[model samples]
Target: MSDDVTAAADAVRHGEVVVYPTETVYGMGADATNPDAVERVFDTKGRDRDKPLSAGFPSVDAALEYVVTTDLEVAFMRRFLPGPVTVVVERRDALPDVLVAGRDRVGVRVPDHDLACDFFERADTPVTATSANRSGTGSITNPSQLSDDVREAVAVVLDGGTTPGTESTVVDPGRGIIHRRGAMADDIETWLAEHADSEPDA
Candidate 1:
């Protein structure tokens, strides 16, 4: 695990992509600040550039600026972050275009795992994170489920056993933010009910 983490960090530093696990599912990551590396992730996944992706933070505190503003949302974030939830927020000016599809918004999450954050820190910035599988395919739960291309594309593999076998809850609090039904769990809904209106990003 240590060797793989080391190699993953090295690959990210050299503008290579790697897959890392979170409490939810495996996410392919690269140096977010490096446009070329980030573009590769979009290409590899056949993702729509117009569809912005979230950036995983090392901790909730690291994500404060992006989401926390009002006390209700702030408190909500303090409670739910570092867990399996992605909060929508108004994008900051410096955020890259590829991050949120050049939209006025972005998604922020601080995974409840050390290895996930370690990858972010190693990349020297937040990395674009999405399910490790091809777009529209079921997410890979275990390293064994990963394809040969995924394996060969990465410079290192960190087998954290298996991921949570599910995806994170994505919530949009502000106006014009609509999330599909049944995509998130009940707990996430509870949190959203109380803080959605207070979210500054909306």
Candidate 2:
């Protein structure tokens, strides 16, 4: 890996936060198991430490390894991944309370972007994910366009050209709540609908 990628991955390994690209938007990330590292994210974003954040993995199985993944979680992972969709599933003891915001479940995703996928390869563990921007604001889709404050604040930035400029569609598969109107095309949605039916309930 180049020095920049190595440094970014090292930051994560050391429990520091790093800003990186995902197909949907720029995301700030930390080692999913490190509560203190996770705390730094909230402090940096001035985020409500109480608000739960989701995690992104390279693949469904990768995510399942970190948490107390259920059949529904695994089913949903099989159903919608390498696409812009998030799933909420039961949390495991390994996750910190702050990451889940005192909630019983945690969100998980597998972004369709290559650079983001590399995180799973680099960290060899799950990484909590949230948009780089503050709460209630539009997600930053283009890393190149990020303000200096946002850019400089992060330990490293991986340029992934202009992203699709849309955030991932979220779904609470655990509760059967279709939380987000995902950004994929109709064909993909139709595929999701079809696959969802075939999968057994959690």
Model 2, C-alpha of 32: deviation from truth (Å): 1.7
**Candidate achieving the largest TM-score:** 2
Cα lDDT of model 2 by residue, 129-181, tens digit: 88887666667877766666666666777777677767777776655566667
For model 1 the local lDDT of residue 5 reads: 80
Q: Give the TM-score (vs. native) of candidate 1.
A: 0.86
| Per-candidate clashes, comma-separated | 1, 0
lDDT of each candidate versus the true structure = 0.73, 0.76
Note the residue pairs that clash in candidate 1.
174-202
Candidate 2: list runs displaced more than 4 Å: 185-202
